[model samples]
Target: MNNRSQISHGDKSRNTRLGRLRDLVPVTSAIVGIDLADAKQMVVVCDHDSRVLARKTFRVRAWDLGAALDWAGQKAATAGFAGVTVACEPTGHRWRILGQLAAERDMAFVCVQPLISAWARRGEDLTTDKTDEKDAVIIARLTAQLRCYVPEVVDETWGRLRHLGARRERLVVELTAQVQQMRDLLECVWPAALTAANYPFRSTTWAATMTVILDRDGGDFTRTKRLGLDRLENLVRKEVIRWGAEKPGLRITRNLFAALDDRAGVIAHRRGALERVEFLLADWLETRRRRLEVEQRMVAVLDGLELTELVTSIPGLSAIGAATILAETGDPHRFSSARALVKHAGLAPRERSSGTFVGRTKVTGQGRPGLRLAAWRGIWGTLRVNPVHAARYTHLTTRGHNRLKPTQAQAAVAAALLRQLHAVIVTGRSWDPDVATFGSRRRPVEVAA
Candidate 1:
């Protein structure tokens, strides 16, 4: 035989042996479901075939992660398969390290919805006893069917902005509560001050009014002879000059004077009423100032983003409004449809139907409350300036539903507004009243790049 033939035959014989070995190999891969907690995490590693490879508790540390990854890799290699994919349920901000570990190891990482896991466990078993081992298995099975989603990975910049936005909301709520408390405090002695102030307890002007009244030598103006009404009017004008900058509007000063008139004979003489009002007014002012600071930061952060311009193009949506909506909703395209967005925001209609008999449907209110609040606030702003929205509001209130109340009609309009917002954001197009209001024969708008 020739040397070439001999070499070729030997090579063929070697390839046959390798092919036989490959056929004998069993394909194996793992899906990890980690039930994350504050101190220790429950890690469940299961094969693609739904067999548990390892279930153990590990402290959240670098060493434990390395150990888990090594174990899963060894198991997969022993079973003659590819590498494993890691999954975890996001419990607040605890999943960040897990994601980092997966990325470093080049494993597929996913977040399973807590609701999905909890729902499955509860329905499959009647008891609510939480077990890490069982949850790990459930997560693995559900993940096999792609029952998980990629969470929003907020970078440092957006994370700071998100914190600021949350802070602003908290301050607003606190300021509102303080204002209500101030109203009650004053009501104990002077019930007419709110009427005279022509504003709520937390109104910036209301606090300013108290400041002026407090600064006067006669603290309780109800006596009336001490600081006359005209002098109080002078203080209002001074405030407009002091904080109003050089703005051309006198509406605040005018309102302040009108409120001062209401302040006449409205002073509370009780020491408790006086002290509480003073304390609450000062707190309300401070909270309002902090809220303004948060707003400024939010606007700055939103302006820095690549997408804010597209958002601001919607009429009546300032930078603050745009920031709130974007932060709460994440990416508009992530949602399958506008209806899905509504459901995520807890605005989706809930049906009370069984068989052919149908009951009244209402919004679930189970989704993100912040998103719903931001949506309604955005709608209110649109209604004020957009003639298109104004016209829609008019039609909705009058002819949309014969039996719908005014609030229900408004709610219907708000839902439409959410759908339109999704369209505007996704299409990268400014709102066009002509296209939105009039019947269109044109092609649908394309999503932006």
Candidate 2:
């Protein structure tokens, strides 16, 4: 096993020691922790030593926010603090407005992980009682100990892309559910219809044939038979051509006849079933159209952003995929290093082990799920065509020891892709295959003699 996979007690101790030595926030700074909620927020102010100086609750509004911060600033000034550090748990979208306001006012806005705050609350108090006031104090104490990080506040372009990407994800999920529901309906009403193509919905030709059967003929395969193979083929061909799909093949027409001949005839309530299918088809089509529009908007937004062309220089990665990944990541230069970028995507490898028993290693999954998904999908296309990713994946899965499963290997490749994307964007350099897979089984570069 790789030494990194095994976490020993000494490692934990060393990490704790290092964390204690690091002074993330100045001791003279005042920490303002706000327990955020939808309508109102509970705020707490503490000095460097975690002494509660004041506490207040304010409604989440423009004037209210100003008053709350102004009150905290007054308290800090009275206590002779050097500066104010605003800290909060990422409570939904409530923190962004506060963080932005704090930024505008030149206050250091930092974030504490929810899990860390929760643990900190329980570790010392040993109580199950939880309240907003208590949580705000905990946040302030954590901030005092430098257990918070500066939150990333993306600018306008990235904000738009993130929203678009989220919308696209929802549309895709709805489209998938619609497709599955339609498939189930087909299975019940017309069993043989599914046999026409491997992925009927994905193929426009198959979709055209199904549309005619469902809409015009009222899900009546027998009417298609009465029309005979020649006329049936002509009708399907015309429909396919109208939809800009491929011409119907002889096998496709034959399959329709074969469906009619099958022992399992049309199920009862076939007309009602076809009507539902048509409704679902219409909805699915609309969702697909919306998704395409979102993708086009993403491309346009990407074109306006810097470093897009450099990121897209990787072989086989589409502009849409790059856009989604970039939107999720925001500004790559903000990340301290490529590994930090991978960790932000939740692709960081984690291990669980005891004194004698070794456990399976897996990803931390502690960061943005959307970013992880986009990175995985973004790198998927490059696995076959991109030499660097292909070689890295091969070496990871086929190595002598510590061989990873296909899924694990794919995730590793995705993390590497994220790291490479970050490196390229930060350095303002195009992707180089050799630089990506430095020690892998790449062919040696040749020079003319």
Q: Which candidate is the best by lDDT?
A: 2
| Candidate 1, poorest ten consecutive residues by summed lDDT | 20-29
C-alpha lDDT (0 to 100) for residue 414 of candidate 1: 63
The sequence of per-residue lDDT tens digits that candidate 2 reaches over residues 1-449 is 35786987657655764464244356777889898887788888898677889888887763358678888989988889877888889877767878877877888787899999978978857676689998998898888776777677688988899899999989989988999998888788777778877767777666666666666667566777677877766777887775456676557656755676664535676778878887887687678778999999999998897656987898978889988898888888877678778888999988789999889889999789999999989877999799878988998899998888899999999998898888788888888877787723377689999
State which candidate has the highest TM-score: 2
Query: Where does candidate 1 clash, by residue pair?
Result: 196-262
Listed in order, each prediction's TM-score against the native is 0.78, 0.86
Candidate 1, residues 1-449, lDDT tens digits: the string is 47855666547655664454333222344677788777677787777566787777877653357677666667666765677777778877667777877778877677788999999888767787678778888887777656666566677776787787678778878977887787666666655556544454424455555666654523444543345656665665565344333331334434544444454343546445666677766676677678888898888887776666766666777778878776777667766567777877877778899999998977788878888888787777878887877787787667734556666655665666667678777777776766667734367899999
Point out where model 1 deviates above 4 Å.
1-28, 61-67, 200-205, 215-269, 306-309, 350-359, 400-403, 438-449
- The CA lDDT at 127 in model 2 is 71
Give per-residue lDDT, candidate 2, residue 361. Answer: 84
